[model samples]
Target: MKKNIKWLLLVSLSFVACNNDDETVAETPVTAGSANFSKYVALGDSFAAGYSDGALFKKGQDNAYPSVLALQFKQAGGGDFTTPYMEDNLGGFSSGGNQVPQFPRRSYFNGAAPATVSGTSATVLGSHVSGTASYNNMGVPGARSYHLLAPGYGNPSGLVTSPPTANPYFVRFASSNSTSILADALTQQPTFFSLWIGGNDVLGYATSGGDDSSPITPATGVPGVGFDGSYNALVAQLSTGGRKGVVANLPYINTLPFFTTVGYNPATLDATQAGQLNAGYAPYNAGLVNAKNAGFITEAERVRRTINFVAGKNAVVMVDEYLTNLAGAGLPSYRQTTVDDFIVLVSQGVSAKAHLTAGNGTAVPLQDRWVVSKDEVALLKTATDSYNITIEAAATANGLAFVNAKAIMDQLVNGGIRFGNYHMSATYVTGGAFSLDGIHPSARGYALIANKFLEAINAKYGSTLRPVDLGNYQIQYPASL
Candidate 1:
């Protein structure tokens, strides 16, 4: 009986051990499977440079997604990844004693709102960094797809020219006045690379309210002229010599907080103010009616063109080019904004509000530069799709990992993405995903992006790359820093 009891106890212990082993998750060893990580390069626009809170500072550069990826790559034999770091945390740089207004200092969340930190930007754009011939991170803040292949893109002399042929960010660290961005990257002989261009292709147009000043790149031109061709050419060059890389598609510009933060109907007018606005637009309304009666415009267009102000919340008046030309009747194409339109974030600024209060949108109609009409939004969507198609095809052709940044952005805008215990969305500052500028991502948000890149890289290369904990990154930087 004693022998039987001992045998029963041993059998019970063996069963428990077997169950535990079955439930346990095996730790996958870190590896760089089927790929070389000895030299890694990152090429993109502001996002790749970590331009958060409106500027690229040392801290932001340190937390840039490329830098984050390099840390993880270290475990898998990734070599040194150097960056063209700014001299100070102040953000902007000076060019010949004049502060470059284009590159302003980073903003911080002041108790109530975001405010630019007070300091003179000390980094000099003409001052080249010593001892570094080629940088791992080749991200230029305002670069477009075609800009990478343009000669003299880093020439300091081009900075003074009208429209500025050179980007100040690239001019700071470019190898030579004549070397293009692509040329510089190729010189480094990177074994692996990441490409995240195309955002700036449409960003300039969207931010400028689809105005003619920053025209959207044509969808069907050849390389160095159009988005599709330029993007494909970029991929082709990056993939030379059987190199492996990752490419991310462009996200919809409209979904960003920069375009969505301000509402179409933001003005709340009192009864007296409303009456005054109505009286001011009465002549234009009467002219519209006459134009419709004269068969110059459709009745539907007449109704859409009519500007009216209510005593409570009201849509601000702005120019809509899509409206039928009523210039013959001495009437401009004017209409009040609707929910479908997007009022740019600049419209919410103190100066802009004062400009609107001064009868710009009430008595006189606002210009096309302040609002993006529903028609213009559709144009942006079409262009974005065209660019994305080119990007995806390039990835497939090159046999590279592809990240659907559009889907990730859609998730952020529609709902929210969860990482560990925290949730992030595209809600400007409060959402914890975007920076104060509403365009770039916050530090924590970059960590999420890094994880996504890792996921794509691991899946494509069949490697085991560990993702970082979101809790390690901060949602927003403090004002003191």
Candidate 2:
């Protein structure tokens, strides 16, 4: 009986031990997976550089996506990350005793509207950083993908001269006059890298209201190659020698608060006001019918272009080159803007409230940079799609983690994403995402971005870096900073 009791106790102990082994999640330690984070390097454009509120500053650098990512990477065997920080907490840089070309410092919402502080950066720089080896972050604001491969891109001497010009921000920390950004990263022979280029490629065009003067493709073509040769070249160099990295694709520019702040219907009117507005557009409606009957335009276009203002949130008239110009017959390029049309953020306070609705107003039609028309928006969409295709292909071919910037932007615009215990959206202020510029993301937004890259990295490289809590980061830095 004693022997049987002892055997029963031993069996019970063995069963409990087996259950504990299976249930304990804390037993396995998170690792950097197959990739090495000891020498991580980042390269790209403004987004990579931590540009925010129309400017780059010290705190912005601290909250950079790469900087935030490196924090997690550090716990998982990542090396110390570095950034080309501004001289002070006050945003903006002074060169040759004059402020830079942008609006002084950065713009910030004063709780009422976006406004810049009274002055600019008073601090002056003495010289650029000497050693190239110590540099980790090579993100240059306003740099296109091609610029990263372009030699002498950081040369201050070439800024006023020929083919290869210098970026002012790069001038502060560039190691040499002849080294390319890619070359500098190569010098480190980084085991890991993160590339978030290509936004500036379309950003200039988007902000300029579909101005084709700004090309998305490289200006200088490499013959016998496919589309986005520069991008492909960049990928090839970074992926060479089996280096692992993460790259982000372009997002649809229209989804940004820079374009989405103003709505299709902001013009609310009383019954009398609505009637007056309708009478004013009567000529436009009659012209549409006459043009359609004459076969100058389709009946669909006639309907599409006809102006109809309701008592609330009405669409405004604007010029459309597609319409037959009948200026001599009293009809011009004017037509009502469709829902597909996007009013720019600059038009937010001034758009529907000030123009086209008032009787005494010229009704000259909102034009140029005031809005991004349907045709323009469609063009941007096509270019974005094409770029993403190339980006995805490169990532798959090279075995690099791909970050879908488009998806992130879409989620932020449509609904909020969970970060920590809080919900974060892309809305300008309270959204805790975008900065006052309406173009760039705030510090918290960058944290979310870092987590996205980390997720892709963990999936592809098997890295187990934990994501940072978004609520820990600031929504927007004080304008004073």
Candidate 3:
């Protein structure tokens, strides 16, 4: 009886093991939560359009941040994305035997220096650009925050003119001549949107060495006034559809390679050359004291205006408008650029190379437009801070994600960022961050930006989207192009 009971227990255990040996089930991938990517739209400036190598070309657009993001979005149920492609890889356009206004063809580094493809580029005809298809990327090359809200901004009638009331890039595929960029984007009824405006507002002024426009009152005048009003209105409108989006703030312009590459004290002078430069400025330095004593300038202005050059790394002399007009006193307002002063990248060669002058001969300083003074940098900082505040507040209020582009730029400029197999910095062309234009990002840089956007979206919306392998994105076409 005991043997029979033991045999029965062994049989029951063997039967349980056999039942557990069936095929296992595979788990399904995740899906979009509340966010819908059935229709995605991107609203921004040149960066959004993938303007690189100094022009908006087909290759650049194909690698645009939005385009890169759309591919990742596809994995998470995102749908089709389209852009108003330029006529050809050569970029620029011509109609009726005339070149497109304002858009010079793409430039490439031809070993020696930057050069463009000669003659007329292959143009995209009116038929291709026309139709009711909504443009997924409405990133007008030069559009500002206010321009997106301005009515009739895509009017074909104004594309060829000076203070262009309409944007030529928009005119290429605008649904109607009276359509604003925001209006056109709205017509698509996007389920998801990515907006990065307000860069051009202060950028236009900052890049011009503070000569073109004023940064003050930008995005933060009175509640209903100027940049502040326009920016708020644009954000409010974009949020109307309750579609999720991400907004990026501007970087401090002075920190960019455009303003930081040319150092304030780049003059590497020998002992004799240094002596000559100092001797030349002695009379001008003495004139500053005299001007101060005569009440022409204050004591602080005298010290600030003084120009002294030592044997080693000497400051490049510059024409400062702040110095009291000393021409009456038989002097010019010439002083070396201080640490507070920042020179534009375009002034790199022109500032160091001596040129013909009326009195000082080859030693005359570069003009004020070439160097943005300490005071001007202060103005830029104020405007950038104000604009960023508005951008951050709007993102929070609208329940959208905010990408701190300013921090990314700071990291790139200060300590270079490593993204996969590449190292990108804000050090102009070679850095791989900015293109030949020294403003927009290269393809790899845009890929990294798309990754940032993805990270933000995944975190905010509880999605599982993967980032692009930065190594996959090419930096530029062959320099020979």
Candidate 4:
């Protein structure tokens, strides 16, 4: 009787093992062109919103990559995709164009104030009241990851009590209570979703010179969610009910046109100007000598002096104390001063001068005031790594696809992909990829971004979506002065 029982047990275990093997074999592998995105929803910051040339205007917004992808998807048999778009006016940063109104025209304080007035035309993104279509895209221009989870975040009118009035992007799409962008998106019951969050969390800090003193915190912090916390929350909310989607990581701001476009090359200086620079630089050397005499640490002086020429038309070329040290250490030097550098330096000095100083000195380093320093770059990298970890973990946990946008941006700037007929670099204005602002992408540039997304999706979802032909998009060049 015992022998018979043991034999029966062995047979039962073998049958269970075979069933497990069958289940493993039944699991599908992702391949190109196999998966179809029938219904789609997209969420994230300015890049996702199709903000270009430093503004989110009608033409750029209409031609945003998401819209392009949606159109392509529809042609490929997917259903229509909608977005809470800014109808009458573009909502992000503004620039000047050929009688076509740019957005967020320069502030009064900035030397280059826009001649045109700035205000949002009262309209909603998907107001069926005016007979508009319900939008499925929810890419908020300045939204951080935590903003999405904020109870009143999507409420277009919930948080507008103070100066700068209200965010025009929110005002256009916001419904007092019932029609928050996120809530509306959730209610859509999307079959597929695309999310790219957490850019603004670090962006504001980076652009603001890494003060991090502002009230804003990453989704994990008390007053707000730090990047990690907010990212997880976003994944949790989207992944509920077994929903599958795609999420993209943030790119470093340094890679954008804003940073790369303003590089200084000492080689560009004329002989006379170079002599003047060498003369001006003598004081910096004197300062180093003084430090040594005064029993202060003798740091190496930077070879190049970064002058904020915009401080005044006649503003003297001030030595970049920050770059002085950096250059002394044999690091890369700043390119010569440009019109934009002057504007940014003056603007920052005026508003946040207290925070703009080098330790124990009235002399502000160019790296400290205008450009990103090695320390700040290190910090950004750390923040970026933390954010990417969260993004990858969330995607893995939720069975969603992840796009390494950071890597892609780096490659584009460092010569990774050559799109269209032009060999695109990440330089601002003429760089082919970035627009005038040096921060956002042009229409053709966005198409390249779309290809990155497609690659990730195909790899993870067993789908084969053909990348859009670069030739289909337009690349604008600066008008001759």
Q: On residues 1-481, what C-alpha lDDT tens digit does candidate 1 reach at each position?
A: 9999999999999997877743442356789998788899999999999999989999999999999999999999999999998988889887677677766778898888788888777898767787898899999999999999998999989988997899888988899999999989989999999999988888888888888678888888888899888888888999998899999998888899888887787788899989988998899899988898999988999899898998998888999988887777799889999888987776423335556667677767778878888998998899999999988999999999999999999999988998668889999778988998889999998998998999999999987888888889998888767
Per-residue C-alpha lDDT of model 4 across residues 255-348, encoded as one tens digit per residue: 7655554343212334564466556545555555554455444333322232322211222232333443444433333323433232122224
Instruction: Score each candidate by Cα lDDT.
Output: 0.87, 0.77, 0.76, 0.58
In terms of lDDT, which candidate is stronger, 1 or 3? 1
lDDT of 4: 0.58
- Look at candidate 1 and tell me the lDDT of residue 74: 92
- RMSD of model 1 against the true structure: 4.5
Model 3 lDDT at residue 208 = 60
lDDT of 2 by residue, 50-126 (tens): 88887787888889899998888998789888887776665777668776655247767787777776565754533
**Deviation (Å) of 347 in candidate 4:** 6.1
Ranking by TM-score: 1, 2, 3, 4
Q: Summarize candidate 3's per-residue lDDT along 248-310 as a digit string, tens digits.
A: 888898877677766787766678877887787788788888888899889988887787767
- lDDT order of candidates, top first: 1, 2, 3, 4
The list of candidate 4 runs beyond 4 A from truth reads 1-36, 75-77, 88-129, 132-134, 154-166, 178-180, 211-223, 265-284, 299-369, 419-422, 477-481
